[model samples]
Target: MNQTSAARPLVSFDGVSKHYGSVVAVHTMNLEIYEGEFLALMGPSGCGKTTSLRMLAGLEEPSEGEIRLDGQRINEISSIERDTPMVWQSLALFPFLSVQKNVEFGLKMRAIAVEERRQRARKWLERMEILELAERDISQLSGGQRQRVALARSLVTEPRILLLDEPLTALDANLVVRMQGVLARLQKELGITFVYVTHSQSEAFAMSDRVVIMSQGRIEQIGSPKAIYRSPASRFVADFVGANNILSGSITETGEDLKISTAVGEFHCEKNSDRDFNTGDTLDLVISADLVQISMEGPEVQNSLRCRFISEEFVGSIVTIFAELEDGSDFKVQARQRDLANMALEEGAAFFASWNAADAHLIGGNGA
Candidate 1:
């Protein structure tokens, strides 16, 4: 989305790890951030996303392996020496300084000419559309305005790479959306690599060219938003990515397609991967909620189940129907709100659930 290419990467992490005493904050992460690419690092708390970002920023040195910038080793470099600028989640700005002065602070520290610094600051402020607020105090500006100022400060240096650590966390929902646009525009216009860190999956998927999902000090998967969401590589990814209904059962048939027998019923899944399964082998099934079809009439489907309706929730234009199987396991079906109105299903009502063979995926048959 940001005019990023695969020909050459601007930043590379080769088997990088960071540790603090007995705890391993980051464990052997290998990643590449392409030039002009908008990459997002997303995970739960203590998942080592922030630690990985810090290592790239030179705020933390890796305990092992190398960190490279433009093919140059930078593991021994300090934050000040690097060309990467980071906008912290807290937006660490000088509270007492006016917007103009705050934006010029980085230029001043680097000893750029006074006139040049002011001119550059004013230009960036104009580009950010906050030139009129140049004299406004940092505390006096709105959350969105302050966010722009923080970005202006980091970007005024025109670094080859920009780093953001949840810069919109403190903003309200509307402001967060607006800020996402600002970042996307900046990256596209400047054609610079952006490394963004956040805990929100929606934010990551909306802004990044690729999303690096981390868990427990390891990188779970790195792929485009669509690939990561549509075809999760593991059970943890499937469960964490979205509202997926995971079923555990024994495989009755194998090869190109698989037959799984569970407490609810016997289901067929399209074998989408090279991983093989044998007869009577236990396997886990990942079926995205939207893949589950809801219909008034019982139609033929490769995988169908008689489920009891537990509940239904309407979110905007989509409706999520919650159901339970005979085994008491939870199942969910997502459908358009308009369609659900005609289905006419009530609590404790029984409905038939069905999915196509290709909709189900076989993952981790041996308790993975």
Candidate 2:
């Protein structure tokens, strides 16, 4: 999420699609990754995020359309000729080679002079705080240290764009946080274009200037984390991007305030997108857990549902309340811990769950 205002795209996928026999891996993606920006491509397994990255890296060619870097098509380019270097999840360091040698491997392949390669490798190692481990064997290092080594190796080539394929997937929780900061800082200081691929929405939200959400080998939506979370373009985007509670129904009324009739009840809703939805059209209502409020006495808001409190989970500063509607549908509410204390909730106790109409997002489409 670096400074990308008025930025030109460093990479472009123009009607790009990939096929393996009868299987369609990626289906005609049209996207642009701006220079000096952290762009994340996120989705489930086999959704073509890694396939897109591989195509950009020249590891795999697109079956249709063109992939361009700086407006120049590179479909026929070799991996070595492309300026995009990737940090793989496995790291892929040479087991027998020293840290310094591993970091300098790319330079060696390009036939850089040995002395200059050592100097550059040492410089990057120093930046990664692993200069002391330059002479150490790959097997002698810890997981975090190896991750840094992989980062240094990818960055030592001074690529114009850095492609990351879930490089932090192997780290522990704390290490993952630390590496996230490391990656963010490096991207900021260097101001290089980054195309990251991951399945974690939190990671994408925390690091990227914009997130590209994919589903079933096609792009669902592309927007900032805030935009995507607050106003998802489709039911799939809403479900995949966050813990949003969705209700299926048909439009009973439409105007400044839309209304949907569902099994739970009729809910007043607000449009999340600019698309026009008519009366009787199928609709999916998305409500964030935090937006759902609870009252033991009675309904305090417009859209209200009466349900029994099933359980409560306290996680750090937030508390999650799980409940079941009269129709037996699961419902959840997230609130501050202090707020939960005010409710004095008990299991199996009937309560009113409510939310403001402004907080409910109406999506006129089918769900995931």
Candidate 3:
């Protein structure tokens, strides 16, 4: 994705690092967040995505380095003092108070007049489409309703920055998709900076303008969802972003086009030939399952491999075909069940798997 020069970053982290005792939770990192952009921090558990979000929310301070907002240092700013609000995963609403009262709590804390607070609270509740449940207690609302209430409470304060920590994790699959739409609309309408933390790739990719991928307390890569998925910078990113078929190979020829010799066969991959590998260097080729095409007979393609089908898994709309190469290395091919049935594939059937030259990505060094 191309960076927009018109939008200056509202928040910036310079050499920011955090640690608990001797255990480093976040290593020295630098990032710039554009104003009004929806940025998602995504990674596995213990990757420090959540910790970095908390640090941005002022819930924790870095052990070293500094954090800045609009060029002003904010490492010492308190959570409440900063122009930011956080929505927790649990939708932390007061069970005793009605939805309206719950949303007004922030306004009340700010010492707004009771009459004005009620008017603004009701407006925000209506805006969140929860006005019908204004008088209903938290216990009486559904998961989606409770989420709206929590969002109303945070947004009622008119904060410039919003932090969400897996806010949709508690909802069912259908509700999660619905809530994603709600959040996306709200962010676009408000034009506020949103820093969302989640382990779900779909959630992050669907709503984020950019995604920051973390691993082992360090940033693996930062790019748009399409960029990261299509051209992962590392082996970890390739495996993490999507289901990739990682093939080990050595570079036999290089220059404008690169040739890799693997146990399965020799293939030409068109990517990063200038920087990643030399003539005799070994590398890992990351091919996405979706990119691999299965055919009963071999086709004339730049890269084709003959493999035997091992198993198949049907996942609603798509099917996963697991196959083993001649050397016993396993890989997966994803296709629609209709296509799989049309191909009349069997468990022990021989098939040819091929992909476009541009689809193959080179990642990692010899050891990888």
Candidate 4:
């Protein structure tokens, strides 16, 4: 168990459900967010990630159940009284206002004195390393600078919990990475809870201490990024996480060494204690693309597939090879560019994809 899990949760959504008339935005969500932890709500559009965040921020009220803060019921709390300031995707900064005044907006709303609010805003601006640009207009500042200003405004109140909704979406690639570092560092320095909602998997996996995967207004899974990536709890999670090739098959043999029969071939997998497998039970086999190896000649591995190369995608040092299996299903293999430089890879060329049984995981099996 995580140490944070052992501690009392700072925020709890107990049997929470949100319904917008006949449509369900969130359903029976039971989640505990710990103090000072950076938690990300991740999913595709309309997956209710944003709705969940909005509920916690008091922007939307749940149709059923309770939203608790520090063991007290706060479902009816207004957004301002909740102390959960949201940094929106738009930044929502006033274009005509100077950066300093923009950062002071939140404090000003709370009826804070002019001098005190200015001091607080300036303090946060310095912390965000944008004090020099504080006097400039919002339009004059860069995207990253504007982001800092928005963050400063949100943090000016020194709220115990902060909400962010795709705050880095507008920045360029390089700026996005830089802001990710800034957010991570800021979260660590402040030791306050950060509830971030984003559809980008890279952002969630890169910065969050824990990620909540949602789909169709329901929580699919909640775990560390590594855990969810390595061992997806459901087929939706496996597909959404990417880099995973799921093969549907039926169990041929079970117990210590589990064997599954698929269109490609029979493959062995390690039995997991969390699930029970029996003969003739149907299941899905999940193999990560990075764990798979491609070669012209077949290697003596527990699992092997002869696939025709479809394409190769290059991103920095990594290369992802897309191939077609015998059943016409897509298979992917990810490797370092240097590792496959010697191999003469061509489109439509056949290659053997292999991985050890230990690297293969089973999902959708009986008793799962």
Q: Rate the local accuracy (lDDT) of all candidates.
A: 0.88, 0.89, 0.89, 0.91
The sequence of per-residue lDDT tens digits that candidate 3 reaches over residues 1-368 is 22477766788888999999999999998889888889999999999998998898899998988998888889999987786788998878999999999999999989999999999999999999889999998999999999999999999999888999999999999999999999998999998889999999999999999999999889999998999998888888988998899998888887667899998899988865456567778788999999998899888877999989999888898999899999998989998888777786777889999998888988876433
Off by over 4 Å in 2: 1-6, 271-277, 365-368
lDDT tens digits, residue span 1-368, model 1: 54334457788999999999999999999998888889999989899999999999999999999999999999999989996889999999999899999999889989999999999999999999999999999889999998999999999999989999999999999888888988898888998889999999889998999999999889988999998888887877888887899988998877567889987788888877766578999878888999888766656876888788989888899889999988999999998888777676988988888888987866776644
TM-scores of all candidate predictions against the true structure: 0.94, 0.94, 0.95, 0.97
In angstroms, the error of model 3 at 18 is 1.2
- Clashing pairs counted in every model: 0, 0, 0, 0
| Candidate 2 local distance difference test against the native | 0.89
Could you give me the TM-score of model 3 versus the true structure? 0.95
Q: Between prediction 1 and prediction 3, which has the larger TM-score?
A: 3
lDDT per residue as tens, model 4, 1-368:
22453688989999999999999999999999998899999999999999999999999999999999999999988887898999999999999899999888888888999999999999999999999998898889888888999999899999999999999999999999989999999999999999999999999999999999999999999999999999998999999996999999998887678989998899989886555677998989999999998889987777889999999999989999999998898999999999999998899898999988889878886646
In model 4, the number of clashes is: 0
Best by lDDT: 4
Regions of model 4 farther than 4 Å from truth: 1-6
Q: What C-alpha lDDT does candidate 3 achieve relative to the native structure?
A: 0.89
